[model samples]
Target: MPGKLTITRKISYDTFVQVMEKKGAPDSLAENIIAQRKYTLSKLDRRFVKELLFGSLRWYAKLYWILQKTSNRDLDKVTAQIKTALILGSYQIFYMSKVPDRSAVNESVEYIRYAGQANAVKFVNGILRTISRRAEYFPKPDKNKHPSQYLALQYAHPKWLVDRWSKRFNFERLKIILNANNQQAPNTIRVNSQKVPAHDLLNFKQSILREDKNTVYNKSLATCLVLKDSPNLEIGSQFAEGKYTIQDGSSQLVGHLVQPKEGEYIIDACVGPGGKSGHIVELSKGKAKVTAVDFSLAQINKAKTNLLRLGHDKIEFVCQDFLDFTPTQKPDKILLDAPCSGLGVLRKHPEGKWLKSPRIVHNMARRQQALLKHSLQILKDGGEIIYSVCSFEEEETIKQKEWLEREYKDAVSFPELSTRLPENYKYLLTKENILLILPGNKYSMDGFGAFIIRKNESVSNCRQAK
Candidate 1:
């Protein structure tokens, strides 16, 4: 007999519906929604809610495709409640092998009734049952004729994104990235040197391993750790005591590229949530004068709270647009972690595949160009700028680099780029001296593109370097 809707599953369903209705980032919105629940959920309950919510969003397109094949009704025409219930049920049925199909179908049926759509119970249940029966042999677009559509449905990405990527990579490489985006992202963290050196953290090996079985220190980057199978952390004593903060390995590399030094001032132009800013302060041992700037006051406050928790309250936080903001003195170095398509972090933020469009990428690239140009104005002579984005798109990465080189005669690649990196990481540098970490790389890092350019004593303008 099918069980009634459990509290955990109900919360997951409610959160999923809210995300769909609001069309907000699932990760962000789900956090706020779940936090508002009056009753405290168990650890397993929290994990189930996140898995169900994120997994449904992660494989949304593919689930919808399966439903369209399995059902006679047009999903778009169905009520939002019915559609979301089906997708959630189908996700568990197709991708979550641990979840029995009967439970998947029954819970969805119960959710529809729970949501006051008792009429949808039979409809959702019938479709989910049909999906389970035909799970192995669902229809797909013909690969040869509709390659983009085929890959989009097969990989659960937007067709336009798949089409764009298809042009830049071979079939095998494209598949690799698509497959990588679908896999679970690792819980990588950067150990706070101020509190506990990464090596010392490892010395607590028996305790660390006991807490997280899948944890491993990253040899190439001493301050980095990869917790392969753990969920996000909030209650851990290590995190509470500011020993480490969760940050992607690729993102951690940006601070390495900055190479903060004592007495030097650094500016993070678009310091969203201040991860790099915190890392810079840690790396400089609280000696570097850093100014973290962002346009949104909310983001500034969030960064302030986060950094204060990390025990670095000396750093300045400025809530102003990078283009208009200026410090009392020019910064020795500037980091432009510009906003882009976020194509590189699909594994972690799967909603981007559906929410983002190519137009958004082009718009972000234009903003990146503006930020890059302005960063040079506030940087001291002979100082370098570390430009990075969590995307590998041509317009946002290489094209921006080309534009800077063409427009500024004094802009030159950082001479010591190769030597600054660890020997194992030297291969990440490209022929143009850009640090390009494509998705699906062996490091299991998010795709990131970064390059360093130094300013000459007398900045010059060139018309034709392209």
Candidate 2:
């Protein structure tokens, strides 16, 4: 007998498709849903919702590959709504253990009916039943083919991405990167020393999960605390208390790279949601004249909310594009956490494989170039600038670094990263002043890159540096 439908999970699955099919990233889509309170979901309900939604979208490429084999014609010929039903059904059939196979097929057919795809009911049932057989439904990837093709099929990742990694990473390492992206990332938070010390957080009355076992690395981070198996810190009581900000280890390193001193004027150009800006304030002991700016008013508002929550009263927020907005005064230090293809955080945003590509990577590089060039205009001649992106694409990292060094020549100098990053992070440096973070178990950090350059004081007339 078939189990009764898990209606909430069904609803969640549909919404996930509604948003993700249009290319919405899971995090933002979930946030919008939660904020709107479209339905009252228990914690477990929300978890299942996320599980089904993320799982289907995360393994999109491979699941579609499965569907294509099970179908007579190309998958492109399938209607979007029916196709989503198939993907949802396939996720439970192959990936989910708790969902009984019968329940998976039955519940999916129910979704098809609810979607008003009564015509697809038999089609959905046939495909799902065939796939539920476990052996016959999913296609076996042939390893004898090129490693890129095998990895791409095995991991459900885009072929281009697989090909790109295969060339740079050995087969074993590439597999690690692909697998890690499919795993749940740790919930790491940096304690806001300006508001409360790490020790004080222990007594905050919230259910504290175990601290990261690597106490030495945790200590080396100064105030960062690693949490596993904890509630979403984004809305947890501790987060509300402004005790800490949820940030990735690699991103937190960007603050370390900035290494802002007391009384220095710093610009967090492109401060999205304000994670790094808050770190800057905390690092400077709230003494740095921090100006946080972003092009989007929405992003600027997020920066403001984070700054307010973290209890900083001194920073100024600006909702203006850094490319066009001229600063009142040249900042002594600038951190351009410029946007890029976000290739580094794929573990967090699995849809990236479907939503982003090499073309987007090249386009972002051009935008980053423009942002970097314009940012130099507002920095003091001798001031330092940190150009960082959450991408390891050569164009965004090394190529951009090369471009800056070429454009500035004697006017700009690249520093060695070892001089700034902690000992554990020094190995991440490819040169004196750049950090290319690889995603996976190594550091469990995102794929990120950063370059620090100092404007030449001798070129003080500096308009020529333009």
Candidate 3:
């Protein structure tokens, strides 16, 4: 009876706790599970629950520190329900300007009581109350002496990541990236050109702008729109009709880089949920021969369903590992959107702050190297491959590119990639023609590293030529 968590009648709070307890799950999965709960939540209540769940996750470390400072107790030793309630309460007290501190403290104290954590109610109240009063005076790790700890606690990033990144990036730049990761990411959509022509989408933008000023056309991307405050897109007629697909501007760039021709065959390796594959179809005006591959059957099935919904049915769907799957026909181009540590997109998936470790990044780099090698094998002579990962880790990006050039004498960096980029975005391209998109750039895009490599000859030809 002392430490048991009781399901309270407050639907939103109960759901928030339930979602919080699902450790190691992706943020999206947690959101789905929360939505599937039996309780019917009002629109307002749903928003509150999501804010608590995601915001707490985003600032998990910072909230924990604040609670520890206020309570002078080892939250590590407290029951999880008590800690979660305290974190939720501290998030509102310190971060949510719209929420009254009194309300936050009361709700947390009440949730603890309802959860049967009678011993923690007083502890939770004292912590939240003290935080509400003296949060400004609370101490943080010294920036000079404990830079990693300071940045981690101040920005809610993993200390290991902060320490690792600090070695590669200057302090100012690392701080910029960390701060950007803590901010709300915009919802970017790639207009399905087949369904909504540029002129039609322009008209739709004007209409939506009339309703929501935060909605605006992307300056550099002709077929992209960004919503700083996104509405319920699933309910919108335009989204329902497949006029646009929810994708980040960073990912939309991958489609542009692929530049699938009308008759060219393209392979999207690691086609998770098929966003880029669908983009290829739209870019090619539904004329490119495309094959989407993923090792997970669930991912391939999801891609198949999504592509079909977007009116792209001719594309092949293969549920096999990219390393083993070879196409019957050689592809003119390949888009190896390989999986990585996902350190680049931490803003969108804040759970990574808690879930990811340096070891994960190192392990992922090894897999990426293998995927790149196998992809080169299946490509035709002179065919190009856009090697991409949603990561900025040196091991995954520059090192992988270097390794390809060293291992395969025929592999050369694409020469004309600079000419393909929009004028404004040419800055994203390095002198070597690699696209290095950092999170805190003016585009507000996720961090990503992509480079194009062309197989100058067949493997046997390469050997003979050497």
The candidate 2 region of ten consecutive residues with least summed lDDT is 210-219
C-alpha lDDT of candidate 2 relative to the true structure: 0.79
In candidate 3, list every pair of residues with a backbone clash: none
For candidate 3, lDDT tens digit of each residue in 68-172? 766767878888778778877888877789988887788778887877877777778887888888645677889999888889998988788898989988889
Error of 1 at 33 (Å): 1.6
Candidate-wise lDDT, in order: 0.82, 0.79, 0.79
Candidate 2 per-residue lDDT over residues 247-287, each given as its tens digit = 88888999999999998999998999999999999888988
Better of 1 and 2 by lDDT: 1
- For model 1, residues 352-413, the per-residue Cα lDDT tens digits are 78777779888998888888777777778888899999998888888888887777855554
Model 2 residue 137 CA deviation (Å) reads: 6.8
How well does each candidate superpose onto the true structure, as a TM-score? 0.94, 0.92, 0.91
lDDT score, residue 56, model 2?
Answer: 83
> Worst 10-residue stretch by lDDT in candidate 3?
1-10
* Candidate 2: regions farther than 4 A off: 1-7, 33-37, 137-141, 198-220, 230-236, 458-466
RMSD of each predicted structure: 2.5, 3.1, 3.4
lDDT of 1 at 232: 37
Which regions in candidate 3 have their CA more than 4 angstroms from the true location? 1-22, 209-214, 411-413, 460-466
How displaced is residue 90 in candidate 3, in Å? 0.3
